[model samples]
Target: MAYLKERHLFPGGNTSKGFYSFYKYILSQEDGNRILCMKGSPGSGKSYFMKKIGAHFAAKGYTIEYHHCSSDNNSLDAVVIKELKLAILDGTAPHMVDPIHPGAVDEVLNMGEALDMDALFLNKKEIMEVQKKISKTFERAYRYFAAAKDIHDDWSSLNAESISTDKISTVTESLKEEIFHTQKSGYGADRHLFATAFTPNGIVTFAEDLVFGFENKFILNGGPGFGKTEIFKKIGSTAQRKGYFVEYMHDPLIPERIEHLLIPELSTCVLTTNEISQTSFTGKVYNIEDFCKADVIAANKEEVAYCSKIFYDLIEKGLSLITDAHTIHDELETFYISAMNFDVANDIFDKVVKKFEKFE
Candidate 1:
């Protein structure tokens, strides 16, 4: 009914590695929960199927999270209804639910069965050709991303070498006093996923929406590779020790590095800024530049400019290649869509929705 929805990525393509996955983190808050894993072809209505289910719950005032496909943001990798401990996902490539399909916790829903096999068989050769093209297109995209990553590393190293560990300690300690204030006896849960992704549309982040609901929101500003993650990690570690759950929204470029942190237990969130966010800070602002050597950054102005230009150019090329991949994907979808029997597919979707009604 209301505009109450959140978007995230389960599997994201990036510069560091070709395909990165955080699908396991979807609905990870609770195990043994009901999971409806959809098995289908490209245009088998998997995304459309999930959309209807998500809308149904949202109309009832249920806040849902759509785990969008990084390659094609319009499609979903998963839909999480945390309160119901239920999720319906496109259990397909890149984010395949596991080698066993549904695994032990998930219940399989096969939309592939609704396909008109005779029709698909007629286009078998065309389908294979398009699928092969899609694979090659993505490979080209990853090559460009790989090239960009090298330059980015060189750029980051320029600032990283001059970081002040002592200053980092000082600010983080202040954060502990200012944010945590007290400690708990036990440890807290830590969940990980990407808050931002490098898609065909370029770098996309839902940081504002992800953190908007928090009453206490903070933005961390700093130079590249300085101490953004270090600060967030410090805050997250401190939150965990103080019995608070932390959601570490990692960087798409460097999956290991956190770009943002969420501490819902404290109704607080602290995220890095710049191209990643546009939200006005409602809480404290920690500038990582304050923790790094100013003169070192000053000296590397030329290097920063040089590396930045090359890195961004290479990244743009990669985005174009990814766009090619998306185009190829559209062609592949057409084959399946042509063979799809929506009347039968909708019947299957209706039955699946019925099974999930108890949760509503």
Candidate 2:
């Protein structure tokens, strides 16, 4: 689709085409995702273009939703913007619609009105200068995938006797590189951390160590109850309060629950189940390389490597590693109570205790 330059999109040449080209560039992405930040004079057509693009996507069988960034005086961040986009695309409940963050709402509502927005209208010379800046700033940082008319068509092309591990690795690496580049543009000197809720159990403690231990990595592990998620929320909220940008990666396959609690804020407290193909601290089976990426709440690199190897062994053996640890702990407690079984239980527990005790 042709990009709607300011002069072309509006009647009479007044506003510059700076944001328009940027919007067009976003639309050109393989995922059909775009987050346009409109800044112009009062009558410069911010709302007009917003409506136009939203309608265009809807007509193309894409989901569309409009958000008033100034409503409720919230700060607009990438997390909120992306969630809004996803909510529109997914047709989520109306209650799921989020207000601007309390911290940002006042500023947005006030600044939004004071700016002419229409003041961006410019002559051809100004438009040219703006376009030049846009071209220079936005390099082709993304690699485009072959577009498919439909999802089925895309899957059909991938039908093979067997999927090659090498191809999957290549695609994963390329996607990670793309994400790294995109984040580099938005991230600041201050690093942010996010976690699930803190259960009174050691889950909360584990999460804190993981976050404080890793520089840029995230640690995600599902627990049997809501405790873990609760701690994650507090950590996420704390990070946001400390001026850190956070983005939650929601589990796609599970129904939304406590994870939704942090949604309106756009903090990274939401979590989705890990992919079996990816390395995750959760039960999902992962390769050694995937395990290496985990922030295992360990003190040193040696512990990290050991825990990863242990996780791989457990996954390969089809053992529930987490459950096994808990079960063994319970057994240890029970053995201590039963005078008769103490002999056997003590022997079995001694070896396992020795393994994890070093971490303490």
- Could you say which candidate leads in TM-score? 1
For 68-171, candidate 2 gives per-residue lDDT tens digits of 22111111111112222321111111112222232222111111332222433324355445444433322110000001112212222222212344644443
Please write out the lDDT profile of model 1 over residues 1-360, one tens digit for every residue.
122355555445454688887767777625636788788899999998888888887777676888878888777888877567788877777667642334556778889888998999998899999989988888888888788778877888998877888988888888777677556678988888876777767677776677766777677776567767777877888788888778888877667778778887677778777433233555788778777888988999899899988977887888888888898899899889988889998899788777777655
Candidate 1 lDDT for residue 229 = 75
| CA deviation > 4 Å runs, candidate 2 | 1-52, 55-215, 245-360
- Prediction RMSDs, each to the true structure: 2.7, 28.8
**Which one is best on lDDT?**
1
- In candidate 1, how many clashes are counted? 1
